[model samples]
Target chain A: MRIFETPLYPYERSPDQDAAAPARHPVVVVGAGPAGLAAAVDLARRDIPVVLLDENDRVSYGSRAICFAKRALEILDRLGCGDEITGDGVTWSRGRVFFRDRRIYEFDLLAEEGHRRPAFINLQQYRLEELLVRRLRDLQSEGRPVELRGGSRVTKVEPAADSVLLTVETPEGPYRLEAEWVVACDGAGSTVRRELGLEFVGQVFEDNFLIADVTMKADFPTERWFWFDPPFNRGQSALLHKQPEGLWRIDLQLGPDVDREEEQRPENVVPRLRQMLGDDVEFELEWISVYTFQCARIDRFRHGRVLFAGDAAHQVSPFGARGANSGIQDVDNLVWKLERVLRGRSPDSLLDSYDAERVPAADENILNSTRSTDFISPKSETSRLFRDAVLNLAETQPMARPLVNSGRLSLPHVVLDSPLQSPDADGLPGRTRPGSPAVDAPVDDGWLLARLGDRFQLLAVGIDVPDDEPGLEVVGLPARRHPLLDERYLGGAPGALYLLRPDQHVAARFTDYDPERIAAALRRASAQETDDS
Target chain B: MTRLRTEPNIPDGDGFYEELLELHQGRSKEESDSINARLILLLANHIGDREVLREAMKAAADTGL
Candidate 1:
């Protein structure tokens, strides 16, 4: 069955619709896209009751936001659907850049060994949403308090003294609901954001790219192929990527002033595809869309009890596949903090760190996305001259190859200056330093990341962890067990202690076991101590 | 820190100028500009010193001012 045509979550009348007063929920998430679905799944896993609302009952129509990076896959693993999604997608680590039909350079994203997931997986965005919906179903069958209200459109959002009021419209009627915490994961055009009168702030590029997803039976290697000024589409760029189920995504850059409606017509699009793919090739167009580059985001992600995440919080040009990937990272960074605040384990002020950490991450994503867009579509003649010069020299010169920016594929933004991280007392590898996400290594029987998510973990290499400490799980590894673990974590130090946050980011590290320091860092990480002094 | 060597670094200065002009020979104005840009990039990469590049840029911009 075509999943896109099927209604995965049909609308059903809920008891809250008939209640006399607005029913209150601990957490209410709007929009069932990648970010919203992920946020709901995370809260349910932590046993925090959450309600997810979406205007549509089925997956999104087109294949939007296709590439899932390794860090996002790792987060999905914590959500319990990583392996399934990874197996069902096309995994690729190599990409080739070309100029006028001549291949110039190729790159391997994951050159090192001992990594579990590939650098990226190309799957239709609909498949990702379906998998998350299935995961939500699995959690529900296990008696988790999670409700998915499809066809329930959030119309109004009003902030109160301690709670947020939401008006949801459904086929049955409109209902009023109150939520202690509201997470808006709606897409670029977010109704929740509009109701609250919040607007995004950034630059918007004046260029349109026509994306055509075609299905054909051909032998093409699963790799990204990017071209600058190809013969088929002269004076502009083109990109080709392999997707699962015999689908190929092709993006052709159409300059600033073009009729968007006329360009997407099948008659107009078929000729463009025929010129590029040749007349002998048998293909069928699956989806066609014309998207403009926009690298804009909200100034802040959090607004009192109403918090915004995903595209509702930020939007970037689709150059580096940073849109949905960073959205999932936003969910990963937020769920744990919300859980702690709800359980009285952390103060509400702890939620403020979400703004501090994620805003910087969003800005970094925007900066990278904007730079990539500029390289791909040079606005002026001098810019194009320099871009072409670099591409020309890149054919034989290695130095010029690094200057060729074909979307510096998405990487996890390290939270370097987070208030949660305790100052490092012991020198170690910078890759696994404080404020960086935990790097995975081989443990005794499985991977190290397998044992370190959803809660605070203390990883001790050749050190005895105090077992009596509450709220901290300890995983002890013998000395020199794995060379990667030694190089990445120990870094010439015989033994060390590391504290990991619930999201698997490094919080603190020490050469010797110090309970007081660990306790203070934990307090700081949870926002229990507002002041460092 | 490396300084921009304004003194005679190339032993055959006239020969170097002749060769550089030959590099842009028979090229249009656009092509010559592109060749100059590429040559600058290559030389800047060979120097591999940002301080020297910055000083050279400042000196080049100060020409005829």
Candidate 2:
């Protein structure tokens, strides 16, 4: 029996590089969307050759999904663009839910403490694409070239045993390019997913929602304003959010039966706005569009040499701002794994966990977005009654405030069982448990895990393991001078040590801190070779 | 709240609630849309406020925003 089977090929291919042809990249990314561009950036930063392709002539226009979670901000920080994006984007700290003209509920996103980053930043998607493009160009100028091919449409993808052959149709003509790996980031209706015969299953909401980007001169607060009921607009609702520019994004809910063309007429929207705000407030319409929400995911994110990221892998409703953020996170999870495999630091099986970990994250986001949609647009009488009761209870009961505020739901750090987290015999509790978002933790200069560089870290909280632990390097998190040190780590539970991935996600947690057990778990998490094996 | 429709002698209240909860959780497109339409109508009737209804309709129109 063959223990190691070669990657299955879709067609036969030559092994030798053509002497007359221009140089080919190690990785060829199709679609210059957030996911594809991010992957290219990650690879380029690691001195890897990458070629990014997109069919569009220009960056994505108008406002697409613009919200970024704190986790995604950290990824951008790793790429050296986090501060620039965060500095320019709008930070929303509060939200309000209105029932007609009356305020039903309000939320303060800043209520949580100890966050290194803000809860979210709203910036135009185009600006992000522009930033990626500029960064890619700068990297190319610095000698680590990342070839960006725009107006180049991928007409065919033929996966060989060792490489992927792509036939692209440019303005000049059709051309073929070969690479060791391919990533497809071409929106929800991904051609690559179809070509590979992957299943994308989910529900598409039937209601048509009209979004109008306009400059509004009104006295409404800068926070997110959601109206469950607005006077003069029975059976309809509206969302008003401030954008980075001196503009507001106004989303008006439309029934499924309404005609899109008639509803888009400026005459209809302007009058409705005049009624909501006084008649004298002037506004300029920048763009108007109708979008239908959908929740979907491809059955499999990887197929042979090709992988799907972003909307290609899954799509979520815009309610929770999960679409763009989740896609960016997908690339974050994939890029390091791909680099390790390419550099021979890890086996190809490391790529398998990408599907296992990210697919669940995608599913969770989809489910959350779907639940939000249902709550906002309840179908059954029972659901409506329940929602109303919850709202009413929230108004009187101060304790229930957090449950009503859904904005707090963001992606949690993944706690996988990996070799990076094996602890030593002298157990330290807080050190071994998976690390969560330290948004509220007090900053201490000497805290080992806190001060560890923004990369993968092995924290030996209590055990004095020599700096080596097989495939992992252990660093002792020194006991703090603070009185709370014992209470925080060893007091409540078994003092355990933890291994954290570069993305600040916990890979493994060990209670006993035993060297042998720690090593075994670490090897398993990283998929490294074990002595027993 | 005004009751639009009620079934008499519905067997196993917990089981029935569980099924609806599952359907809601699953969030099938057809199921959600029908539910949304019914909710809008029910709320509109309950409030008996044309202005509020109109605002909801307008909000629904601005889906992409």
Candidate 3:
């Protein structure tokens, strides 16, 4: 059987199952999806015990999320699986937008040269999960305190003042677990969120999309091709993407009122594919499903001791590939704060920054995806008129090219007005400003981000080297080492010092070397002190 | 930073108005709406100054009211 078809981590009764008292862990991740696995791996890497519970033993059944963006890949690199994923996935940066029969214009998502990873990669969700599971197993072999229990369903969640009680159901029997903190990454149909009586509040788009993953020997280049009102699917949009193997992902708009069962039938889907791909092209359907997405998120991610991450926290339409990518970002933002709080290194209130920062990120994702959805599936006649007009003008007009919204593809959202970020003191580059994730550049040995690793670091660019401070790792790089580094980090300034958070987001920056300011920013970032400025 | 000029700016105002009406003469209501949308988009792109566009949009929105 294929890896996804086989049980990778079958249910085995744990010692906690037979204990007279419920065994407690430092953290209990309620699902083994990408967010949960990343959270568990991060916790274990920090030497914190984590129990990852999942409802199934295998990876995701189908190729659910295929597009992994660069920021998500960078986060995976910190988790020790970036090279494996980028190596096994099909990388592409160019996307062509089609209006009816003719191509309107194309865009390169990432035009810069110094980045370590590409703009995006198309890998089967199962394969990505397999890689993460392999990483989890590797962590296990290293005597890390992380456990993956498959076939374990979290049936109930009860939050308390200091702990959360979970009732999990398994093949053997139902058992209880108490966790100091619980992270729910149980996907859109989240059981934990439901049990807590919380709902994702936002717009539910009125459209259906049929996804058909086909294996073929076609010679399509590795670029994203999006169609608006195509000939095959009149008055609708379609998407074609290349995957790692011979498989290709084709999404066709089925409108809002499609009969899901009939539309997903191979008889109806194959003819549509033939019309789009030409009649002589031979292919076989690998998996087929119809989905209607919602751009929504919960009110707050943190609910007392139980925190929600991934789809349980928020969800966006899959057009921009924001769903899984943002979910991975959610965990990346979450795990660091959680680890610090669990280690008694930071106050519990520091976890509140996760909500403050990520909720805005979720809102940004929702806004962008909702705009893309409205453009692709115009809600009213007036909106459709404007959308078509832009497309009509985009045929020959370069100005109209930027107006055509074929799913404003996913990019990392900067955390704006965040409390963790210190206000900009010197006029450095805005791209690497406080609250923006660190931009990767070439360093002495390898990439800049690879050296930054997953910790609080003081990056001194084009300036004199500083000795390591109490809790921050000091990294000094000369401006002459790389011109792109100077362009990205220093801009017009002579030199700069940046205090980077554990997630490699800029906490603060300065033109002069002031250890006092850097130390205060670190304290404020960890919630050890209040921001006075 | 240009403000929306409420006073006449086009040198040949009637001629431009006549030309605009002539462009929509043979079009249906839906076609006119589409053509107007395309025209607005073209003009908006040409005038890439966002503050001027914002002022023009506000002036247009408050015209009848």
- Model 3, position A12: C-alpha lDDT score: 91
Chain A TM-score for candidate 3 is 0.98
Superposed model 1: Cα runs more than 4 Å off? B1-8, B58-65
Compute the lDDT of residue A391 as modeled in candidate 2: 53
- DockQ values, each candidate: 0.70, 0.03, 0.91
Q: Give the DockQ-based CAPRI class for model 1.
A: medium
Question: Fnat of the models, one by one?
Answer: 0.50, 0.00, 0.94
Worst 10 residues of 3 chain A by lDDT: A461-470
Candidate 3 stretches with Cα past 4 Å from truth are A107-110, A530-533
What lDDT score is found at residue A200 in candidate 3? 82
Candidate 3, residue A32: the lDDT equals 87
Task: Report the poorest 10 consecutive residues by lDDT, candidate 1 chain A.
Answer: A108-117
> Residue-wise lDDT of candidate 3 within B1-65, one digit each (tens)?
45766787898999999999999998899889999999999999888888889999987888895
Point to the candidate with the largest lDDT: 1
Residues A1-533 of candidate 2: C-alpha lDDT, one tens digit per residue: 11012111112222222334523557888888778888888888887788787876456766587677777776776776777888878888888876656777787766454445577888777777767777777788888857777767788888888888887777666677877888888888777777777888999887778888888766556788777647846656677887876778888878577888888889988788777656777888887888786899988787877888999899987787888888888887787778877888778887787787778888888888888777766667766655554554556555434444333356654434333333333344443355342121333543333454434556655546677666665656544433344444555443446665655555665655567766566565565754555
| lDDT, candidate 3, at A67 | 87
Which candidate should be chosen as best, given TM-score against the real structure?
A: 3
